[model samples]
Target chain A: MTDLLRFRTDAAHEEPAVSLDAFVEGQANASAVRLEAGDDARVLIPYLDRIMLVEIGFPKFRDGRGYSSARILREAGYTGELRAAGDVLVDQIDFMRRCGFDAFAPDAPIDEAVLTRSLERYDYHYQPAADAIVPVWKLRHG
Target chain B: MYKYDQYDQSIVDARVDEFRDQARRRLAGEITEDQFKPLRLKNGLYLQLHAYMLRVAIPYGTLDSRQMRKLAYIARTYDRGYGHFTTRQNIQYNWIKLEEAPDILADLATVEMHAIQTSGESIRNVSSDQYAGASADEIADPRPWAELIRQATTFHPEFSYLPRKFKIAVIASAEDRAAMRLHDIGLRLVANDAGDLGFEVYVGGGMGRTPFIAPLIRAFLPVDHLFSYCEAVLRVWNRTARRDNIHKQRVKILVHQMGAEAFAAAVEAEWQEILPNKSDVPRAEFDRIAAYFTPPAFEAGDREPDRADPDFAVWLDQNVKPHKHPGYAIVNISLKPIGGIPGDASADQIDLMADLAERHSFDELRVTHAQNIVLPHVRKADLYTIWQALVDAGLAESNLDLISDIIACPGLDYCSLANARSIPVAQKIATRFAGRQRDLGELKLKISGCINACGHHHAGHIGILGVDKKGTENYQLLLGGSGAEDASLGKITGPGFSEDGIVDAIERVTDQYIAVRQDGERFLDTYRRVGMDGFKEAIYG
Candidate 1:
């Protein structure tokens, strides 16, 4: 099992990290927190310092609380490495980056070239995130 | 309608791909049905009585011709050549296959649409008046605010797991066409003393087994604080709303138990704690969002009365309504025939409407909760031609406020929760009262599939509720229910009737109202004065 999942964005001054295992059973968490294990917010904020890797827990990718959580963590001052862990597929990597995740860890082994191509599927930036990337709204407004 | 920027498009595209992968996993036995049910529902896919049903969101009931055409395409290709426009202003394709749903969702994503939050115990589609931006009496267009609210509420971490589903409706006009009074949160845009827009917010109002008109929580809330205030309300509801009993889980029941004043006080306390937070909508952001909804450049025309064309005059009296613009009229496209289903529109009809909207109405069309469509911004000069086209398309019946223009839910035919069939009841009532529409005047008929009251029968002037009597279908009639400014639940008159006898019983009540009404009074007014006694006798006797 991969112990660390790294998430780095262009906006980060240095690499920042989080650990999925420490996030799973934290003392500051409540029952609702455990129920929402796939949520990044639960582990993202508390485990920001000592961790260098974060997992995108897709109990099921259809349950997209993880995507929003990943975005939230990235927005809330996390910058290191992000990995899509369980149920992660080749198609979701492009969006994962737009939402602020940087690394892809598909359930099955993925070819690096194919994964890179997936990241290049869309050439435009749209959503605002920790990456400080120029968004489509800025282009339109400017 | 607000066009989706690339951000919106990307999110929808990503979501579609995600659902497609999820569907593959389900097929591969990677996820159980229990695990996949909520997942599918969050994407607006439902496993109904027989097959999967896909509900496509029509945000705030505002759709342009292009979106409508896409919906038409979906109906023709993926569905049974027809779609049902729901009370929440979304369209549902009931006969959808589980395997085909992913492709359908992909098709929808291409149009910058998705079914996210249309179901599940989270914020459902935010609905507003179909005549939202186009209504003449509106203080301001409410769609931008609705859109802002939609964004604020969509997948908010704290709100995704609420006690029950939440519904919010915003209406800017004095006449509450969106039935704001029956929503979980009803926002009425109001102008303050300085002629600036604010909201008169109502909370805890909903219809189901126990119907309650939302009580006024805040008479006037600053427009800038809309998001924060809503956040406060939801937070309070999440913490206190009942979760033990599914029947009493709605915020309405909680409000009823605690009383509206106490509920409002609790919400106020919560709001006080969060007043200085980032959730407070910044003035700049409000202005930015509101800019998208600025009315199109409407040339000022003569306010002087022209000699009314006889046909145009009749159409105006029955269908066209006053617009805030001097020369423009808000036109209703009647979905009801003399005897037809309340909200079902064929693929062909949908296509024709798209064409008509593009040609005559600034490329905008609105699907009302009343199961009718509105070409909300038609000019007076073009009204005659538009009316002719609508008539040619078999859509012009001039029954805007008539008895046949009923609100009926997809009862037992579609919904698993229904106790009895409501469509046939609505059809029978419409047919029975077709000849007497002119005499019936402004009667509002609302029918519910079951006591859940999706049809909003409880709030209708003539409310029909379908009930199951030991295994047989029976119907109950309720009188004097109004979903207007002075909204009230209808009072059940007497005994429930067999399905066959119910329409005649309604006809008898209508005949009674006609005979005893004092000079052009509506059925509701007359029912209020004489009470249910006279109507009960007329129906039962």
Candidate 2:
């Protein structure tokens, strides 16, 4: 990460909903959990109820196992807050949202204006994600 | 051909500016060779064995006369008075100075052309059939969609940092002339029974150290969903493709390990979640792009002349093809000459072709995957004049799709990955088969420097694979291969041959075919009719 970009975390606002640095690993954690169909309800139910934030690891930028983990958690009714951690970049924020990440912790500082501009860069939408946004086709044709 | 809009022009201009800055920094010693290496590559500048080679992108193999003339100017000014058209539908100048490279790029930008992303891990040039808009057998013109895909994928944020290089090709015809099946992702334009336009998507087919033909992921994907589907595919690949071993980083390896079914499932799942998002291609946008590729106004006439002038007839039989328009024909300009470098066009020849393209053709030129140039739309009446000009320029040889019209990679002479020199082998074979052109009919001789198959030797009717043998060069011969309608990989016949022995071995194989073929049967057809047994026996015997 020699040419890496960094962003500072805001610690003044009541610890916030999700910390950019935390790495979540439990079965109930949206970003790092891997669950089987037959997991015990006792363990799953309690963990699902208690966890409020989850951190997704990229491991390497290409290794997207964490994206699936986040999506599965979102589908499984975990609605607290989702944040991306390791190897995050400005370019991946749109995809991160589609995979159920609500907040991103890109290695570079968050340029709110730039981020806002990028969020609306392309008006067309596709794929069913946590955002449930309407694709451009539906807006025009439907 | 798709014309460049403001966005396309701006992008090229910006890229030239960026490369100029990088060149300046490198000259000033602000960056080390290692640091500047990838940066230069991303801008399509390669430090080859001799000098810096600059590869200029000809998107989807389509270019107008203006761009072609500009290429000629660059060739005359910055290069060794010649340029090589590569298998990727790009042109490479072998002798480019670091100082002059930026100026050349600036000149190219004037005609809305620049050599960006022609090399490097980023999305390389998107290639399509050279006969894209005019081929008679094509279902629809694939250029507009190819252009859309090119625009969407260029400098795409999520895909810029992939595990390895990625390539995508689109074919709109029944025959895969562009060899789309051998790319990272192959898109075949097709119309469903319901008359809906869509694509048959193939994933992970590529030629490299590890060669794999792409596998089908979807039977039919609607045209509007093109971007979204492609996005889903890249996301899955970017996430799961191997990273540790550079050799195993291509999407093909991942697709192989995951199996096409599992890979398709992963893509579907990702698509399901993202289909509701903001990246899908809109129908209007598709129309906007497609409108640019509409066929030019054609005058109706009998394509066949009363008696077909002998020379024109010979050229038509070999070089001209049936165009979508009845009166027009697609003219394939063969770059391969007997004992000459495949794909090399001198500045004078380039300028001559450009002038002819403007006067007789539709002012358009295309670079084919087989290392040749093409004039996509030429009128039947202008055939003789065009042929005469081509002959005067030393371009007309009436050897299109012939043995001497070989496809060869720039082997040890240029490539860092080559084990043997490919150009010399190509030269030897071409010379051996020269003057005997009438004897050797409709045979494709393709040679690759290494197994990476840059020259597509595996798909040739007579395939030549160059390998290093105990610090010496050797060539292996493969027969019964086809890159067209019935595409199949060639299988090795027997033991490898030394450089001197390879030409003789190829001669033997051709002689076997000449003896065994039915009247007027193609080499590939003959090989298929009587399997490799006969050809193998002749070679090994």
Candidate 3:
């Protein structure tokens, strides 16, 4: 396994990710799964407790379906490591983090200083998401 | 106009800081242009023909004297002496710098303004009726709701990077002044049988290469479900909209493919799922926002407006409309001057208009979808003084809704995407029809430099689209379209014509209308009554 950003406490998985069909076939032993942009995240919700890591693919950075995919999995109570892999950039880090991406495996390596600056930039957010950041509206009203 | 609170202020301030950093990095060659383009575009900065064009959001077409004055300051300091108000009711500065763009946004932040989401493939600005609060025809003011939509959509986590740009419009009237049906999502505030207010939601209406009138998705959605319902709509489109073909990515195309019935059903199912989780705006928070838009204390104004001057009388006849309050009137300010740019407002003119708003209009002003301005709450007695001020400022044009009042895009002269110049064509058409403008009456002529339809040529009563024909510029004329309650797409009259020939072609169409029109019929009415058959014959022959 190549170097990847991880927020999870456990050691990184050594096994290669299996396809969604393969994971569903071996749900009892399957610990890592991969989802393409077109795969439905809802189908894996029942087996989320057994899975330790889920890698979602993005063929291009401009295709935003991966954000929706990450959000759907996290909001459905997936506590395992959610890794965003392929064609990601420093700019999308802030949004990907907000959408519950705990790990990143970009096709191109990102600069650590720029990544830190992007993630720590905004203290407030406009909308509630899968992340722990309270939406600006809640703070205002309270 | 809604004022930004401390929360709003902090968010805007943070955005300015973030943009400043991004601009610094882009300038220092840390990121490539392909990477920096989408980020700058989200903040309303665009690379145009000669310079970077910056589009500043005028939320729901509403702003105050203070905000308006700040706009003038930005125009004078950062840009050329003028800014162009767009058909979407936002203002565009054509000559912006990549370096100074961040400073411009910082300056706008001081006046409770930012250029966020004015462009790019995310949700763009939320527009509403210019006459939202003051008009008699509306069920209620739509500004508060527009502001809510504005806030919720800003920096939305999941739907931030849409396949194509999304536009949402909110209106509370039967008379459609904001081109509500031409947006990606349109909401009309209405009343149920129980007399409770809600929205009639329309999804998938837009114009570009393909023009569609949004179909009704919900007849009456409850008022409290505003955020949840909209979230459902956005999520459905975001997840399912085609990413393969950029042209077929808009929600309108998706709606057509899925069929309106199936699309609405999908939205309803998503909305039902969202309802159990409960993410709608709180009633108290909604009421808190609504309090800002309450009516100002209005004294009984003079019943009669002085019309001793013929120019004032003509201006009053065309530019003024009855407000809900009998004492006041809604005054439409014409940005279009014959033989000039349709929507260009100079620094001096902008300042003067701001002063007028401060003095006589409860400090409020609105930018209309027709690229005009409106002092929504004005005393009828102060009409003469305002007219004189406008006359001195070269803005007292008595051609409201007339042929000279054209809606045009900043075409090849400024925009990088344009195939021909829309402004020069608009200037020529306005000047040619100046003498007979009042006689022809209420011709909503619109021009676009390309098929992108930024000028809303698809909705014009007399639509002119400028196309690139081989190596030369060409223009096509279409007849019989309306963007009102009687909305219909226009039909092309004939083959293309030269730049000069199109102006003459327009005149011939009007001449035919005058010859065969019935009593009290406007140009649109005339065109609608007699279809494109006769107009095509006259123009083509």
Q: Best candidate, DockQ-wise?
A: 3
* TM-score for chain A in each prediction: 0.65, 0.61, 0.93
Candidate 1 second chain TM: 0.96
Instruction: Report model 2's interface C-alpha RMSD after superposition on the true interface residues.
Output: 6.9
* Candidate 1, A20-39: lDDT as tens digits: 44346453332112223333
A20: Cα error in model 2, Å? 13
Error of 1 at B100 (Å): 1.7
Candidate 3 chain B, poorest ten consecutive residues by summed lDDT: B273-282
Writing each residue's lDDT as its tens digit, candidate 3 over B378-454 gives 98888888989999999999888888899998899988999989999999999899988889978899999999989
For each candidate, the DockQ is: 0.08, 0.13, 0.66
In candidate 1, stretches whose alpha carbon ends up further than 4 angstroms from where it belongs are A1-142, B300-313
Residues A1-142, candidate 2, lDDT per residue (tens digit)?
A: 2222222243211233332223233222342332221221123334565655555556544444556556556656776556665556444566567667775555545545545554655444323455666533344445
Error of 1 at B496 (Å): 0.5
Most accurate candidate by lDDT: 3
Q: Model 2, range B145-213, lDDT digits (tens) per residue?
A: 888787777655446556687899999989888889888889999999999999999998877667777
Better of 2 and 3 by TM-score: 3
Which regions of candidate 2 are displaced past 4 Å? A1-142, B29-32, B303-309
